[model samples]
Target chain A: MEIKAIGCEPLSLKRVGIQDGHTLKVYQDTGGYVQLKKAFGMSPDEIIQHVKDSALRGRGGAGFPTGMKWSFVPKDSPKPKYIVCNADESEPGSFKDRYLLEYDPHALIEGMIIAGWALKASTGYIYFRGEYNYLIHIMDRALAEARDAGLLGKNIFGSGFDMDIHTHTGAGAYICGEETALLSSLEGFRGHPRMKPPFPAVEGLYACPTVVNNVETLTSIPQILEMGGIAWRDLGTEKSGGTKLWSISGHVKKPGVYELPMGYADMEKFIMEDCGGMLRDNKLKAVIPGGSSVYIMNAGQILGKNVTLDYEGIVEAGSMLGTGGMMVMDETVDVVETTKNLSEFYKHESCGWCTPCREGTDWLVKIFNRISVGEGRPEDAQLLLDICDNIEGKSFCPLGDAAAWPVQSAIKQFPDDFKKWLTKKANGNGIEANI
Target chain B: MAAATPTSYTDKVIVSDEVAEFSPEIIAEMNEHLAKYPPERKRSALIPILMLIIQRERGWVDNAGVNFLAKFLDLEVTDIWETATFYSMFNLRPVGRHHIQICKTLSCKIMGEPEITEHICSKLGIHPGETTEDGKFTVSLVECLGSCGTAPMMQIGYDFHEDLTIETVDQILDSLR
Candidate 1:
């Protein structure tokens, strides 16, 4: 939380000032659950309308509109509906959700409660990744505090709106971050993704209409309700509403989590001034603007292009504002090895639900291993790209796309780097290596 | 405390026919998780109960524990292994007491994972997937555990030891026993 002046105050981690921010006493003292009173007073459609006006998007990588996501929960479903919080913070460079879960549990709880009111949901679940197994007690204690205060369970705030939240742990499957796969994991099945069309909104946990939102996205509800959606929308850019929690790491002088209004400054300035520039004052090389899942940009693309750090602006810089997990690499870093590192992650974490993500990730690793050991072919670069092309949209979920993106972009941005992996003998003889 | 985390000791596939037994208190705790789901879908409680029970009663998810859960949840044995084997967190076989899972993903790799891995493995006199002589330590190069800001981190048991260095790792390992 320590840093120099970064221009904007953080809305998400605002409670960080409190010594016991995780406790309910401090959370309630800071105008906490009062939003629930105002929220329940308004009609469900009214709440959704305010959210729509806020222009709030999901903070869990995908920038889908939160208001629209909630509205999709069929109001007339015969089965009981639920609001699910996607607290699976397993993305490679992203650790923003952990900050929220650890420091501001009540904010997320309050957000889920308000969501329950909007969707008429009676139950909620906060699905934490298994790696975060150590932090479950923090969330459990916070939820216990709320229930002790009659803030959760049967007739919350005396409005007869009953809603309760539970904590579910995912063992170690990254695929569960996808909404369908998360729901599957919550249902005590393998964390494999289900098909789209009957998305989580229509049929989710327990085969009921469920709305799965990121921890940050759910935590934004109380603020969006308090400030009124339009004012919140105006807080950031026209396209991206409100502040964002960015997880910036790697080769930066001051590597840590930071929050600022969306598009507050160009990413170059943020990296140079805010993040204290490249580590050891080394020359900047490549940058993964978003989480490791998105496109990788070189120095030419980001150093002086005035690339803003919002959704639209990042897309303008040829990368998605994916989870805002920016990973900066210095000249000492090797692009081929780094991309190969992530491919290993994908291969290790791929749920084996489909062939492309399961086998393609393994094949990518084999090719990278071949290249790393000085056995790479002249065709290996294109073969890598070809494999990436085949896997991009062919899997059950976006895990395959996430696995393929950085490798694909790295090759496109640093073709020479992959080519450098080829042995001198292979390069000289124009050898067509077979793997 | 990190006993229930991401690590696998061996590549050999092994299963135990002996079913695991739990205390009455453990059954009560599992019943609480089962109550969270519906009456018919007892399988929904499998992951949560397995996480809570497997970590404490047993160090790894052996076939015995799987059998107990299958009978307890009214699920088929395939239904049990299918879910258990899918997640990396569930160690299918036994692991050493201190399951040191070093992050080998992009950020951590770029930082200094190789040196840390080499340091720990050599100190333990074992390789990445091997256990120590006395079985006190096991080192495995795991993917990212979402602690990117503090790169070169490892989750020994359930606690995260981040910003790892050779000296700090030595201190941590020395203090572990």
Candidate 2:
């Protein structure tokens, strides 16, 4: 069978010399930091407007317009603002940022420079997850090269735009991906997410105006500025412009990152055609359209609906195009076990800063574990829903919602499978009994 | 197979005396991390410090390490433990040298994680919480290693070994040995 290529070309901007992490020459050979050079000549507002025109949205699950997010930072705020690259790719099924960081460390450095130029921030930081220790080393080497080449630090590229980039490693807390929580961590706090309204735009990172963007979101900027925003905007849908790196994994023949234009690709076609369908003779059972945090959709539901691999289509399907992580499951899989697994993840990762998230995730995991083990009660489904509802809006950050959404959505969509657990329990099956 | 005697602190050449007095490179590594944040907010470095301590020592933070870390950061022991237990990275108990953290998250489980996990337990002659008598391997069920696409995976040390099978796991364990 022939496969049609969709989306933007896999521009090897980030992966030019991925194997050799020592030098920036390969990065430079690939026109690395040229956008920063171009951006240096432009004013902060001009750079901001260029991103606005490009229509790039946050690639870190929220899908918020990146330009609009930058604009939110108070222009009149005092000195010492910040532009944070959310390299905390802790979302399950998402590994694009790690690739970018490992392969194209300089791309992120250049993107950070562009973001710093736009926000008029002198300092920028890449808040990486602790598990990505190897990538951290890669970034460190890249940062050193940039500094040596005079691409970073004061008076960068002789354009009089002084910007510096720093790397901060997160201590294994998924909650730190939240902007405010990231700030708290950056400030050397316990990483408990702060409340909104004073959003990161108004008061972020040392209580100054800040603009935090996902790694991919910022990496797209140098390209956008170099290519011109109008040209870049023409790639994807009207709202979500530019190219996105979709991290497709699970049961697929090709489980790797694919760069594609948003909205130009369909999930089914991408999974079946682009990914060579499910592995071997296995049939598709379900898909967590985004990362593990998003709602799970049955294979039939996905087949029935024509959904594109973009922000709009996913939102229409009651799920977000979160980090473009398409985690596919095959027919042999057990839905109850899947839910229990996700529940335990949320429970284990919960920061315990918020009451609902701390206690609720643990309870949800326990219940799901019981259900998956054939000790489920009839009311457990509703009880799971009730707990999820408690965690959704009551927690301090989206960690609560991230944990609750999958469990609640899975039970709602796969009620029959959940009911099977209860029936098995009635038959006196052991808790560890298989499905 | 003969049992290997547990190496005493003196028998093992301590890399640094400061590490012996303070518990290993975890504190110094944590201080380097703390330098990134402003001094006023040093508490933020607590989690990574505890994690490093556990990783260097293998498995979870014991009471002494937790107490030492708490005093080192001017935090209470309970506060340190709370942070330690909150994330799956910090182990609360002793584990083998090569802590095999299996990714049992949704995507992994769907890809037949039960058999993979069971195979590991049977191979090691220990359950999830148990360590082998030889002290070469310890199997622990981790919530997620964030590599769900290559489900049925396990992490040894900092490296994530994905796309698991009984054969792949055996090779991985052998390679570690």
Misplaced by over 4 Å in model 2 are: A1-5, A12-22, A424-435, B1-35, B38-85
Q: Which of the numbered candidates is closest to the native, going by highest lDDT?
A: 1
- lDDT per model vs. reference: 0.86, 0.76
In candidate 2, which residue pairs clash? A7-A261, A188-B44, A189-B44, B60-B91, B60-B92
Among incorrect, acceptable, medium and high, the docking class of model 1 is medium
Query: What would the per-residue lDDT of candidate 2 be over residues A309-383, giving only the tens digit for each residue?
Result: 788888787777888887888887778777777787778778777799999998997887777666677678888
Task: Compute the lDDT of residue A424 as modeled in candidate 1.
Answer: 48
DockQ: which candidate is best?
1
Residue-wise lDDT of candidate 1 within A1-435, one digit each (tens)? Answer: 232225566678888546898999999888888898899799999999989999999999999999999999999999999988998988888988887888889999999999999999999999999889767889999999999999998988788999889888888888889999999898888888998888889988888899999999989999999999999988888789988889988999888888878877788899998888888999999989789899999999987799988999989888898898989999987788898888988888888889998999999999999888777777788899899988999988899999999898998887767656753434478554322
Model 2, position B124, has a per-residue lDDT of: 79
Task: Kindly report, for each predicted structure in the order presented, the TM-score of its chain A compared with the true chain A.
Answer: 0.97, 0.93
Report the C-alpha lDDT of model 1 over B67-92, residue by residue, as the tens digit. 88889999887788888878888877
lDDT of 1 at A370: 85
